[model samples]
Target: MNSEQRMKSEVEIWKRKMMKKSGMMNRITKKAQDKINGLIPEKAHKVITESIKKMVQATLFGSEYLTKPKETYNLSLEEKEALIKDSLNKFRKTAVVEGAGTGAGGLLLGLADFPLLLSIKMKFLFEVASIHGYDVKAYEERLFILYVFQLAFSSEEHKKNVLETISHWDEVKGELVDVDWQVLQQEYRDYIDFVKMLQLVPGIGAIVGAYANYNLLDQLGETAINAYRIRAFNRNEITEEIPLDSDK
Candidate 1:
């Protein structure tokens, strides 16, 4: 079989191996704990806090792109279909407005993050780029929205333009409140990385993430698979390593 098929088959195998439910939950819980701890420092607070905030912003944008409007709200079949069609259109529009090609600038920093990316520590850059599932030019526009949410812009025009673009994205983004995020704390890190992996495998979709996650859980004993997956993605440490915020 070809490399892609081989890898896909291997993933399928891994899923089958990790099929136990309780074992998977334990692994997920452990992974969540580790991620939360990794998000903060054992003793220091300030630097890790800032870093956590930054990662949260990235993760938020990463996950927000996946959620949909509540279906519990009453709607006629016509309304539901309209909503589905509209959501599809919005994504297409997003693909266009944000740019589907490497150049569309979709919703990303347009051309700005490129230089900014160069200026920052390379490892963080890779991590951030991995937030796009290791696809930079392809997802530049979408990544731009995450940057807008987390960083300071040089000009008001840039900020306003980004805000407008975000405003125009009619599909549901994320939960309305912080508490909503708390509801899924156990899957937080996994979910964040799951979104990135979903971007990597476009056809997999959110349902696939769950399937993959649960499948992996059964196979890999419930721990988060991000570290392993990142390795699989071949994300490398920068040659001239940045001191990872010097707080870890």
Candidate 2:
């Protein structure tokens, strides 16, 4: 197989793994998280959910004003991915520094890290979407970014569902009327609660925060790449191997 074919094969394998049934450990964790979520007051859940919803919406709507102009040059998949890797590294360092700084500040700054980190993640997604040749200025492209974010931090069951939608994004994206804010916020919160809770603790918060943020960025980067790969192939943008010299 040629390079594009090989990459397509890898993406298919990743999708299969992503869609697989949750293992015992995952089930156990989900059960525990569910119980914890159950104990929280409904009002509290609503407040948190709405907060995240608005935060994300604000970021999405305002990002166009802040982002660099969309890249217009046609690039082969491999060339596009090289640019993505460099962008990921830059964003990862920003996340790590932000995590460590806030974590070292104890309760107040640690609590502040939520919205801050959320912004960083969203910004990175916007950049990734741009690199993948999607215009985030378009509403549908913005929705795709949200799906990628959800896929990165959601439960296994949710991941499977999101993967299906992403796999058929061309058909599905047009039909997507709105996001389910409750599921988006709850799944994201539950996925990070355990580790992030530790980051709120005073003594080791810095170390925990830095480590958590680094890994989180790494996960986001991988998810964004594969998510775009699914779209790229679907659009026939990467149907054949193209030499690097032809990228210009």
The number of the candidate with the highest TM-score is 2
The predictions' CA RMSDs to the true structure, in order, are 20.8, 6.1
For model 2, residues 13-68, the per-residue Cα lDDT tens digits are: 66666656678987787677677667655654564566688766765566532455
User: Global CA lDDT of candidate 2, please?
Assistant: 0.78
Judge candidate 2 at residue 141 and give its lDDT.
78
Model 1 TM-score, 2 decimals: 0.24
Candidate 1 regions exceeding 4 Å error are 23-54, 58-180, 188-248
Task: Give the Å error, residue 60, model 2.
Answer: 4.2
What lDDT would candidate 1 get against the real structure? 0.32
C-alpha lDDT (0 to 100) for residue 248 of candidate 2: 25
